[model samples]
Target: MSSKVYTTESGEVVYAMVAEFETPADVYHAAEKVRDAGYSRWDVHTPFPIHGMEDAMGVKRTILPMVIGVVGLSCAGLGFLMQWWMSGVDYPLMTQGKPFATWQAFVPITFELGILFSAFTAIIGMLFFNRLPQWYHPLLKKDRFLRVSDDRFMICIEAGDANFDPDRTRALLEGAGGKHIDLVEE
Candidate 1:
């Protein structure tokens, strides 16, 4: 059968395959299996994180924090240079003609603006990369998925790459012990 590709509200491609599980353990195990299968964009939704499940799923930490840090540093540096260049180097206005290059005087303003710029960049950069400000997800359309925040646990693998196979993937989830096994079509 031809693969069904789903586009989420975030404009991300997610292959929708639903699995029903009787227990959280089953859900946890299924998530681990899904990850080991090498599906890149995958997620698990459980009432809570199951112990040792992350190891099983082979999940890796996202680099978004590092990206945020670099961008924040860049903003801070730019802010410092802009302030210094404009106030001291570019347009030298003599208030009392104390000193053209006053590091002490510049320190307060520079630090203030640097922190401001860095903080702003960290927030904006995170939102941009995360595609946040979202109020809802297409998963809300799945009745079974609603249980995710409650008693039920779920793992979803996106069809992000060429490796995604809807039919075979569904089979894999089922074989891993998924019960409901619904197809989420975008």
Candidate 2:
């Protein structure tokens, strides 16, 4: 078995049908309609995260929250362990002659570390899963695509997937009332 090698300067190009819409509402509706048609490898770009657009695209909520939960729990456990080892077992410091393993002192650090771990987990998981921190992408080269960061809403359907057929995808976008029909090439 061999893994495909892609050392090229660009990501594998995706063939897309481009559309230009006069309003954000148009692209939002187009996204919903396109999802209903069942092209799984598609994406929508907008100047902002439009309301209800995620549901329209059939995108499920991310699992990163669950990951954060687990991290938080682990952090709590570890924090307790650290306090136990340092104050109870290792050093056994008798502060004001108070009893060891007092909950009063442990509470703040435990809570702080738990929240810290969860935050770190959420951020790292989001970046890893989304393949972010990336410096470049071919689509960023498209002339009008920059509008997606501002006032434009656009959707893209990737080519080369198992279900992708260039002509058919183009027709579907057209029927969905999409405008422009541009391809992202390497």
Candidate 3:
């Protein structure tokens, strides 16, 4: 198989080789092989989630929860402080003879701010980690991959991978039972 390389207008090399599989199991095994082969910049796509596929792909647990927790707690503290400063120091409004810094009155806004911060952190963190807002991908150019949303399963080894070698990678996928292999260019 010939590996085609293309240089972009900015003179950047961008391309990926995609291997199509007949079933989810085939793609799962292919992902295992790719992971064992030490390829980091590779991904597997399937119409639906496959059991054990995450382990096969060597995917690690995401840190999004931790990020959200930190941000949420920080925002909650800030919200409480803002309310405290406004009521106790800045304005000092006496409402029905209530205390200047009312903890009860601050709970709702603090909780809301915490939830809001957590939600925003979850969305933005996920997008940042997953590299979202990408309007195009090289794999989208492959005709066979169009079935990825339907019935086909695919594994793509990106050119940006440190261990990516077109010939060796293709051979590895073939050995792992991949079929209908195609090269995608950008």
Each candidate structure's TM-score, on Cα atoms with residue i matched to residue i, is 0.67, 0.87, 0.86
Instruction: Go through the candidates in order and give the clash count of each.
Output: 3, 9, 0
Local accuracy by lDDT, each model:
0.72, 0.77, 0.85
Root-mean-square deviation of Cα positions for candidate 2 versus the true structure, in angstroms? 4.1
Residue pairs in candidate 2 whose N, alpha carbon or C atoms collide under 3 angstroms: 17-181, 18-180, 18-181, 18-182, 19-179, 19-180, 19-181, 20-179, 20-180
Off by over 4 Å in 1: 1-15, 20-26, 47-55, 90-97, 133-137, 159-168
lDDT of 1 by residue, 1-186 (tens): 225565656775554666767677787778778877877666777777678776877766667677766766676667667766887899977878776666667667666766776678778877886698887776788888988777877767656545567678888888898777765645
* Residues 32-113, model 2: lDDT tens digits: 8888887776788877778988899999998988889998999988998899788888888877989787878898999999
The per-residue C-alpha lDDT of model 2 at residue 91 equals 88
Poorly placed runs, candidate 2 (over 4 Å): 1-15
Better by TM-score, candidate 3 or 2:
2
Give every collision pair in model 3: none
